[model samples]
Target: MAVYTELKPEAFARVSEAYGLGPVQEVVTIPEGSINTNHRIRTPEGRLFLRHTTVRSAEDLRFEAALLTHLTESHFPSPTLLLTKQGRPFLELEGGRVSLFKWLAGEELRRPQLTPDHLERLGLELGKMHRITQSFGGSRDNPYSAGQVRSWLAGLRRHKDDEVATVAEELEEHLERAEGQRGQGLEPRGVIHADLFMDNVKWLADRVGAFFDFEMACKDSYGLDVAITLNAWCFDNGAYLPELCRTFIRGYQDARPLAAVERENLFGHALFGAVRYSASRIRDFHLSPLPPEQLTRKDFRTYLARARALDALGPAGFLALLGL
Candidate 1:
């Protein structure tokens, strides 16, 4: 289930009343992402996707709404909030930002194949989306920046959690070194989806459907952007798909080829991505008071292996493997 809990009509009615959205007859809770609770709200005559957050301060729901709206305005496939009788695109209430969207129409992408043609299309689509998003210039550099990574590494090196913290400390040290070597060589900053798991990219036959879940969207390095996509698309739980990487990189290049520095540091950004998700999982589940499943099941083992590969992925390694 994507939602942490079910929301009842009475509860929703309270929200509806505040926003003047009228009566809500039923509220069917949908899946809860790592950060948000989403429900499919069914009124007497229509259905809309309602995203509910636990605490007012836990999320930037308004930012999400604005981002979604901006993407929609650019003709990206993101769903826009429905208009109320008063023609408002969304309604803010005591429950947080309660906007309704016409449900995303295509089937979720499952086990997406990296066929040459398919990857080409995917890369081109992402390029167009990124171009459009860059036009907005609304967001800033993500707080989860390289500097934050460096600081966190220093903390881990202090070895606060015995064995777990020790291992983290070692890896963190390595990542810190990698970060130093990278030192802004990871260039071409722009808008990126950041979390474009194939699961988030919808499929409509041979064509691309829509990109969903703009919650993690931000401005970051174009190389880092490609790294995140590679993390999501090319690697799975246990192994890396070298062919898939080639296909995806080719596709991405078809849109905008990686620069010399960007291509060189792609592995570091991707390995960093692995550590990023693993840390989040550990912090969200083991370190926090939240329930077990509050953490996503999407495993980070794939990234860990990629991290292992990072040692061997010098410029020569990339050239030998991908002709980059």
Candidate 2:
């Protein structure tokens, strides 16, 4: 869960006043993603979402605000920025960046069920997202790239705990193997959601309520995007349901079919996906001076389970199960 650095009402009120919004009433903190402090605002106008970003991304709010506006205009159900009395998209609040959005209608679904219909729609919407992709929404490369992974691991070797350090070292080795395989090109590039876990997908009835958290959105591999979704949506403990992977992938492939190479690379991409989450969790659990909630709890458990499975069956055996 996101750990909010709570601001005094008076401090937050300064922002409210900037946009001439609200006879401010309540500020209720919502627990979800990292990097932002979000509060549900109850005011004379109506309920709204107030997001205070503690971490900055390559793109500023203007682009995301525009992106949301773009998605909304496309008839996608995303939360758009709300205009204040003065018609500003955001109110620069308390020394930090702050913004408001209309509160989306949503009911969080824990253990989200993956029915055939849901997968089909998800694939369609994801493809729809790609149709509206932008090239320069952000000015920096994504931190999840091969180079960044190496840089982080190099830094981690300094102060990580044994478990974290071991994972970091393993990350180093896998990354080297990945580099050796570099004659193999990455998948074709385009703007991808880059973060499409179950949490980012909201459910309102059978319809996808909205896709929130556009912060990590980036220009990256289409295959990587698929891997991100599968890593998040497919496995439960530490195994792959090729059927589930097939379902989501076929759903995507129906939009734009995967190349034979990408299909063959699926196993490696799957492992890449796992290591991404694993590294992020280890980094956050050790780094992040402002402790933010990550998937570390689930990640290490997944790691241990995968390790046990590997030990029981051996590497060749595990790959055999993956159909690699």
Per candidate, the number of residue pairs that clash is 4, 0
Q: Model 2, range 1-32, lDDT digits (tens) per residue?
A: 56556678887677677767667887887776
Off by over 4 Å in 1: 2-6, 15-26, 54-62, 83-95, 112-116, 150-163, 184-186, 286-288, 292-296, 319-323
Model 2 gets an lDDT of 0.64
Q: Which candidate should be chosen as best, given lDDT against the real structure?
A: 1
TM-score of 2: 0.82
lDDT of each: 0.64, 0.64
- For model 2, what is the error of residue 139's alpha carbon versus the real structure, in angstroms, after optimal superposition? 6.1
Residue pairs with clashing backbones, model 2: none
Instruction: Encode model 1's per-residue lDDT on 1-324: one tens digit a residue.
Output: 545545655668865665555678777666446656777776654676777655433335455666777888888877666655666555555455556676676776556545656656777777777667666756655756766766665665564677547656656755764675454544777767788877677778767788877666677876776777776776655556677777777777777767787766766677677667655544443454555454344443445566666555654574445546
- Model 1 misses residue 206 by how many Å? 2.7
